[model samples]
Target chain A: MESAIDTHLTACPRTISRRVPDAYQPPFPMFVGRADETLHQVTMAYLGVQYRDGGQRTAALAAVAEIVGTFDIADGPAHNDITRHTDKEGYVNLIVVGYWRDPAAFCRWLRSPDVNGWWDSPERLSGELGYFREIVSPRAEQFETLYAFTDNLPGVGAVMDDISGEINEHAYWGSMRERFPLSQTDWMESSGELVVVTGNPADGGRVVVQGHDNIALIRSGQDWREAGPEERALYLEEIQPTLQAGMDFLRDNGETVGCYSNRLVQNIDLDGNLLDETYNIGHWRSLEKLERWAESHPTHLRIFTTFFKVVADLDKLRLYHEVSVSDGANQIFEYLNCHPSTGMMRDAKVMASR
Target chain B: MESAIDTHLTACPRTISRRVPDAYQPPFPMFVGRADETLHQVTMAYLGVQYRDGGQRTAALAAVAEIVGTFDIADGPAHNDITRHTDKEGYVNLIVVGYWRDPAAFCRWLRSPDVNGWWDSPERLSGELGYFREIVSPRAEQFETLYAFTDNLPGVGAVMDDISGEINEHAYWGSMRERFPLSQTDWMESSGELVVVTGNPADGGRVVVQGHDNIALIRSGQDWREAGPEERALYLEEIQPTLQAGMDFLRDNGETVGCYSNRLVQNIDLDGNLLDETYNIGHWRSLEKLERWAESHPTHLRIFTTFFKVVADLDKLRLYHEVSVSDGANQIFEYLNCHPSTGMMRDAKVMASR
Candidate 1:
């Protein structure tokens, strides 16, 4: 294979030749867990990138390239990755999202010697650099995830399994089956593929075929520098108003629809300059409620439709959507030395054990 | 005064009408104590601006309007105010810079019933709301502040006294009196008017003339929407790089020369939108050290020189500079549940008694 790749690249100028490994394993592997019990927790780690000058530099970003460094560590999460990286001048940001099979197990690992030495090291505590962390255990049912394909699971999805090994079970948009089926489908239309991985009957639950999914994702163009009057109009006349109204409607209405939180993110360069990409991650209590809001909700349907159209025409810009669901036992969250607005921390007692 | 406003507006029919008070007092008051004491502390309060929509409507802003409400309470500092208010869309920023005679007193208030109840309330705990507080306590000698004139104190300056009550102090730029002397001159250039509030010889120290002052403040025009190519260059080539580098120099070197922390603030509406104005608040251990950096520091000198040139040429734009020096005792700091980057939180433990 190495010779073949080297020879192949020789035919093309400017193509560097390198040896390729013939036997390969996925950088991150699926979770190893008990067959009978429910075991999983969601973990989100917030890491900061420190800049020296013109270059984007930080140990945190570099650490991300070493994928699954802690995957095999005892009591650690089943999966982890530097899921998000954003940069601005003088500062860079890296976010690691992962999932544990058990909340207690993850906590134990956190207090263990290896983890404590790294996080609580004297050099780290020096305070010269900036850093923060947020850990959440999503009550399994509290979340819904949709993937483009069964082979790839992101963050928490990597810790849990689908209902079946193949795409045999049919799942609807707002049904219970959509979240945890052994074999899953891209019912939310956000995840790219439709293939499914088999699941264990003894483990948690499975996604049974329902009908359709309700979760709606709104993504703007990747670049909007030439964002003329038309682009601004989309934000002002359509996008902004729709989002504001939707949030208001959902909050005022109720929680059955699965909407729990709203998150907005924008990409940035090392200089902290704003990027063209923006993502809105909203939580839904259930897919049915999400569907109702997407299909029947008067204001939301219009807003989402317009967003879809704007992205359709922009060639340089790309948009994506996804949704996922978790069972109660597999979800978890922990908020530490943080502000009141930190997820669940406001009401959570300071250092109080539940 | 009321009639004069009415007469002046006669040329413009659209002028609004409201009665002006004949007698007025500054919303925040000076510290009360014996004069011979060190009598200074640095306070930086991060107050959240709640967002319902696009408006800057927030209890935090409203609370700031009622200045020094907690100053009189026992264990509370003699003065604190929402000294800095900057806003952006969906968020409002309020910063209350204050000083405490004793750092311990500030900690007492944080744990007291009044502050805890308001901050720890259920409404505040909801993850939907954003809230954070950063407390920095620079040793008295660790910080110096400069104001354009007498009678105006921002953050910690509000705690210390100026040179004279009647504008008699002739303090110059780079004079020791700018920071520690009983009476100070308009060394900062940002504070308006050269007037002094009468000070009791027994109550704390005054801005005594020792030598030079450090710390620079930069403010552009009221709006930057039309900030053309020149403006962009100033930020890209001069302002941003200089600011970033200056911070690096201060941190890399020890605090002997008045270099401690770098602060850059932009004026914003209640809605948290950016304003044209920007303020740089850097802590200097001493005035002479600050002067050394200002006059000799390669990157900073270049930055300040360009800033001076630009502000000198533009009529619509405004630029101001000031420097201050404080004693160790009066320069107390209190940090509560905050990231290590917060003033001294990295060294200060959570709720730990010093």
Candidate 2:
């Protein structure tokens, strides 16, 4: 009952009229897109680790590979990237991300009865490393994905079962949260403005965030291919400064954006090797506050205007950004370890009775 | 209606009263003592920060003081401490912890007409600071508190409103979750064992966690009075090594005790000055696994037996410990500023979308 072309689509991040690789058994058929409209929930999972030892890194990598190798349910697809770095006083980490088109399939896989027993069992983790896993099931429009430059899908986009055919749409078709189907709160209109731009933080202040109604933005971009000198200069002279200034503003003046926490991370592979891809994760008390920082904050406006020019003029880079707006409730953070930067900890009610 | 003996509980870290503070005011008379025996909900709040600049820190500190000053009610009490610390990778943090014996009163204050007008206003946060506030309203037995040696209640104890009069009990009178009213999953009988003698980790291996149902133990103790040379030696030679080994074991080998994360924290003041108090926090898959490590893990058993001996023989040390147990469902974490040592963020679902 199935078309032969569907065979090639199995385990493929992208499905064009292209030939398929001879040998690729995905950890799971994460997103075969065989489901109908009855599906309402989709879940994504990310598991990552940073090996502390040069030798253990290999063992840990192999352990992850083994787990993936044994994983046969591709109700979705996954992405592997070299990310994260740290120092002596801190730590470095590597991460693996998985996406599922249907929440039921994810639940089925998670509760796969007896399958993937190692994962559900405590034995999957070894004493020699640090690891983390995140799971989220977002309803329609609750989560969105976009890709540019290449014809291929990556990260969460790959795991989407396209019964909805939404993946092929242009990445820039919508603005912020409106890019998805629902979440119409402020989609028709935008809020926030840039206040001022001074010198670098060590010299003077740059941007500030105020208000509790906030929005958080996360973005990752890297040179997909070789860039011309103009592209290089554009990034160096324009992009880098904006990013650094925004980050400095957050660190030096945490309250300016109603920003609670901000982190800029360098990506890494299982080998503990660094990559060009980076992620900026931050929490603002509200969307209006964050928009104000981006719109009027001289520092952010400059970056956005300049960066838009790059997007208009260039094709050598692939970029993606996501915005998740929260009213500050309906979310919980557990502190396995507490520190100066623990999330939502100021609001924590119970301490782990150790 | 007021008692003549009512007096102010000053900056005293430890105050035993034949009396209560006079000038002190809490945001609410959170524990009105009128709630029925059926009433079980209890809440606690902690607000903490790390000042960046001398000026900003001063301003931020002043802002907090003003807020607390205007609170003007205390059916239940609260404790304010200058406790927190920082490092090169971490910014300084100042914390104030409060307890509420009655959730209704706290809610009434939070929702009171013009009662807490200043707190609800978004404009209150100027965006030039780093601040966090945690609000927890756990059901009865969902939370518990204890005190020993010290005269005045601290942290969660201060806000209890004293109807139960449990704060005056010995710190070690109850086991695990039973310290409170109703959490009795496995409390009547104890689990785990304590063995003697151990190799030191510095030379080689000492203790390790190997089971899945283990429970984690966290405690902090500081000498109330000056410790003699013998006391120092007991800490340095006997206690310190064992505690360090247990922590190192968890950090270096995450799964050994069915443990995922463990942190040893030293307390500091508002100015980022150090205090003798400290805290240990950890996450374990189950209580059985944590118990195995505590009773039999070479590193912990040695430390425990010796530490217990000290508890029996000495009164110079004021000690306390707490542990919280959870499943993947009830807990969620958001990563803002990331480091290698951040929480088990692999399970993190939402990163800020910019």
Candidate 3:
């Protein structure tokens, strides 16, 4: 690893190869260990419901929540969280997020009698409440994770063993792509176009959107709960502005830059109290597009420079991100009685079942 | 109406009664017409799914989207928008937001052969994808809508008839509460505690959180797409700063001021293009709590004053909000295979089913 860093000192900034110094150390820790071939698959699952009129909302959710609480540690996800959010449509949605290092384990848990039986029950479709489960499984090579503080972890981090100390391939342009193990052998280009699987959402029918290859998903997060007043002020006043600007650029004009959709959200407690945490979740057309934006975009440049300038003064402020490139075959887009602009329904062509 | 406004000139600022000049017109149009008792109920529906690994995601979503597209105008929501966002748990979520002025219409649509048949099909539980529907129906008196522009209506506004000329109720504190017709006869106080209907989420069982009455839901939005460069700069530089500060206060310390949860999110197009729109959706314990914050809090005052100060220069910028206070029995929270912090699952007591 040391020799590799030395050899890449002259690596082109435009190229995929990474350049780093022997004594270089990132201000934060990151995830590593692709060498462990056995740990190659990771899966995430969300089980949720949407309801209103109070007639059956409470009863319906209780039925589902009860089932989730019955799984044993061995057969269940590594970690789980229950959250609620009001969708843009004004419905309060309750979601249970579960993570598994092994997709097979997730399958087993889903196949369990109690789980399958509840889903199979006719009560689920009794017009009382709406229920759903969404899951994603990605190979180890398809994803990467980084962290600032090891204390409070999220998503895959909650299931992973540990985070690495100062690593060589970060803090520079294109480091996000350089960190991806898949990027080593694959350019992660998107192939094909989005195809709608059913009728049009605008006209009201079952709609499914099929995306192209090598789509990218990113979760970049910040945590300042442990920050002192000074560090907190520095983050809120200095670091946040540039970060928000970059995010705003992506949210408003990302398509022009290879990005798809971006959302900046604050994490709150179940009772609705806001926590000192926030994150940006987005989807990109391809990993290369994301890389291009991060490498050359002025918005990202400002965020990059601001971080470096205030790195020393920032303590107890954790900044980390996870990036993954998934095959088109591994995506899902669906809607029912939804607005026309929901998901990829409007972007993709309707599928011809013929 | 003129006499009513004049008579309330000395009305307590902290009370629900509104006071405004007869000639004073708001810069933006607002929704009115409580006199028409026929339009008493409003319903919002969210039919969505969560999926990943590519195998069932696109297919499942397409299936659902097709069903939504089949609804006829008279039997369907007045308007719809298909949107997608990545959930905090790492799964991509696609949702169709639908609105109906009559809950009966929503029920008729949901019970339609195509809709119910599709939902009841055994394939729904075939482990291909997770599906759900979340709906909220509130009487006209319990909900209020305000819009800056009639052209870009959202949520209930999309289904509403026409916007009214300058209304006398806005631009002051406590105006939000006063806008709700329900406030005239009811204080809109919360009545019950959240009771978990099922098992514990931490232990991997089904969990349902039943909430109390008068849970306040507010959606505040901003649209600056029509603004020119100067107006945009004023919003981005001067207005946005104070607005965000106020939102931040609610997000981080909302519990102290009656907020339950607050999420600041950006609206995006189907292709993931960032729209020139953003909104903050929040849950509050009670209407009074929210009223107190908007009335006396310095943070809100800053937002109010800032908006008034720049109202003239902000020609094309649009600002709007919808506030609804619902009975606790109307609220539904359910979790499946989720983490403890997913929703009210962590805060409520577990149901002791005898």
Candidate 4:
């Protein structure tokens, strides 16, 4: 029996030549995996188009919907979920991420003739309407899991629910499926010791945990270059205790499924000037673990108390947290899987463990 | 006696310190125009933030409501005429391009302390929660009219009518102007001639009928290196004959209020890639004049026929139109304007005309 992929190809013969060389060829094989079992990291970027005339509003909207739809249809059975982001402003952005059982599944969808046909459609063409433009980049990085806890193995929805709940309230959650799927790869840079765990198999979804240890260093300041060495040292010293406390809390908390204590030294764009600095990013198995550490853990509580006090007088600080769900993958191609921004960062933390 | 400006300065002392540097200052002044002759432009850029999360559905619907509000605001003070255009998709491309009389009065309500307080409120800062980054660029361009029709001018009702008609059929245009007395600017550019009509009575709300020959050539795109000589020639040839025909039609038809012809061009991305290259943009004074030209005149008929043929085989094309009342100024500022993808092109067209 012919598969849906085969049928789609037969129905829509590829009529347009590839704008990029070897466009018809799959960029890479697709990888599918069970929710808790698959460990993948993804990244993505988005661009939006605005038009000059209000009358073309419908046409512009149609064009965008069609483009996204094309990608969704091409990903095939391996496709897991996709989410679009837009502000009532004339802007549209979408995120596609997920896990697939194998790489070939993704490749079939990416190289299928139906995907090509959608882009070549004259009715939904971008050039004729001159209303919108978009670019999507998806890539996968391999990750090593330290621990995972789930009642029924692991599925996309469970991971997504955990991640989404950890982050701020967002409106586009359930519909992410049917859009894209997740995949894995071996390409990545080993930076620090990281650990990952997924837990809570009975009542709720599993928790995937990753931890990193003995990282670089970081300090917070309104402008780092302008700071004296003493100030920078003091800032670092002030925050170190808090981080240590957090680590200790993680060690003690039963709900804690994952913990990471690593340093991220990155550049800061301060009014056009580039400043180098470092900060800590970590993940826990659940909000309960994070809250327990924050509220009751002695070391963690003390560190945060001091850090907050110091930054209270300062204009800017480096510390930030991103809670996210594994919404799946956004497949720009087979080798690439674009994860949501917050979730991608967390996945990065997992990669650091290896 | 102190004016309201003085009272405002005294009341909102924080505006001085929070004001961004001059370089970051908006290119145009901010003020509410009176109902009879007010022009306002609100430009928003949603590239970065809107795409960050699952934002597409919420953002798109919100944009539709926002455009509708702008049209509703214009309906006040018996300003019953309006016009707008959207791209092939539902993204709002442009709104508000006509005429009004009492911009000062309109401004009074727009800048009321109640509204100002909401924007200034600590809990609800204007930019904090929205998907699109916004730049409210308002300007007062000067125009002297030489023609007049009935005192009927562009307003919210007219905008609502058009929007309702479009929405009923397409679902995109239906809610553009449900609220009243709001305004925004849309900027776009075209590789066409500059036609400026000046030196008429600036006081009347209606179009002036006398200054037909007072056209000015501000700048031409023919000198640009990126545009080739053949393309330039083609552009000029295409527009000149149509312009002449329009002029003749205005001269012959007693019902003609005013006439102007413009050529719309594609927008370019930050990396300088041309986007949306298929749409053709032209401006007309009134729908009646356009209809008459299309119906009886040979030159206009031929020009339009050629245009249709050129776009016939294309997959899809979006043609947008807006009729607005102007306060003799390009109400929206281009540089500080947000929706840069399309707004930049619109600005280019205005500069070419200048």
Please give, for residues A72-154, the per-residue lDDT of candidate 2 as tens digits.
55443444344454422254444454556666676676666443465444543335554444344555444444444433444
- Per-candidate Cα lDDT values, in order, are 0.38, 0.42, 0.62, 0.27
Candidate 2 on B1-354: residue-level lDDT in tens? 221111221113322211111222211111111123454555554444435545666766665565455445544324444445442235554555455566676666556544356544454444455444434455544444433333444454444444232222121112333232323232212132211122221222211112112222333334333456777666667777777777767655755445655555566554445675655555554443454345334465455446545755554455544443322222322221223233232111222341
RMSD to native, candidate 4: 29.9
TM-score of structure candidate 4: 0.19
Locate the minimum summed-lDDT window of 10 residues in model 1 chain B.
B15-24
Please give, for residues B228-267, the per-residue lDDT of candidate 3 as tens digits.
8988887788778877778878766766766765655556
lDDT of 4 by residue, B154-204 (tens): 222121211120011110111111111111111111123222122112221
Highest lDDT model number: 3
lDDT per residue for candidate 1 within A156-257, as digits (tens), equals: 545665412212111111222322321122222222111112221122121111111222222211234345667655655666666656655654443444
Residue B218, model 2: lDDT of 35
Off by over 4 Å in 4: A1-354, B1-54, B63-101, B113-330, B334-339, B344-354
Q: Rank the candidates by TM-score, best first.
A: 3, 2, 1, 4
Instruction: Flag regions of model 2 displaced more than 4 Å.
Output: A1-39, A50-56, A59-82, A87-89, A113-128, A144-150, A160-174, A185-217, A226-229, A244-263, A267-270, A282-289, A296-299, A325-354, B1-354
Q: Model 1, which residues run further than 4 Å from truth?
A: A1-354, B1-94, B99-112, B116-179, B182-241, B248-258, B268-270, B284-291, B307-316, B321-327, B346-354
**How does residue A222 of candidate 4 score in lDDT?**
22
